[model samples]
Target: MAFFDDLSHIGFSTKDFYKSTELYEKLGFELIDQEDNLGSKVNFYQINDLILEVYEDKTNSENGAINHFAIATDEIDKTFAHVKKLGFELIDDKIMHLPFFEHGISYFNFYGPNHETIEVCQKNKE
Candidate 1:
């Protein structure tokens, strides 16, 4: 009955991208992917099966916290509809796409009970 496969990643906002990457690397996280999209640079790191996302946020003045978390879903459209039917406040008007990995990723965001951002994404593949 679960719509998501697993917790795909957790994101952190950083004012200094390079400095944050270096710090995460020292903490045993290996950089897996990087991209320049969404008006800023994003880097994905992995330590075992965990994917941690760090993205540039120059306007962020305070020390960062978990910006958002993503849940992996194979059936994006179906899940999106289900979430909508459940009446959760959706952040994205429609599913959004980004060139993230081998192919790309399509996702949408909705606010949780506490107004926390929760992203449901499907990583497109061949």
Candidate 2:
């Protein structure tokens, strides 16, 4: 059996592509490309190696199992500052320290477009 390597990309359905793109951009993602098919729209953003695909859908229901997604960063503070400057309110003003994780690692949550909770974290250097 071939073992899986890693997650290469993730897709999120949104009603507003412009709003979603703006929110992702504030989090350090850059708009890579977009596609339009039969009146449906899809936008793609790249943050380092990770690719985020946002699809504009009108029939998507509000209730979903997944609360949000996360993106790892080396410079959490700088990323947080960028998000703050874009007018996004952090869920907590303090950084969360997890004993289970590596030392110096910190994380905080913020709401994205449509109030989607996004967890941004930094891992300690070895």
lDDT of 1 by residue, 6-125 (tens): 668777777778776765575456899999977899999986677887888788765455545676778999989988886777999899999999999999998643344768889998
Looking at model 1, residue 48 earns an lDDT score of 65
Model 1 spans with C-alpha error above 4 angstroms = 1-65
lDDT of 2 by residue, 40-122 (tens): 89888888888877888778777212477778988878877777777886886766766555566778888777666778878
Best by lDDT: 1
Candidate 1, position 49, lDDT: 73
lDDT of 1 at 86: 65
Q: What would you estimate as the lDDT of candidate 2?
A: 0.76
Q: How well does candidate 1 match the true structure in TM-score terms?
A: 0.49
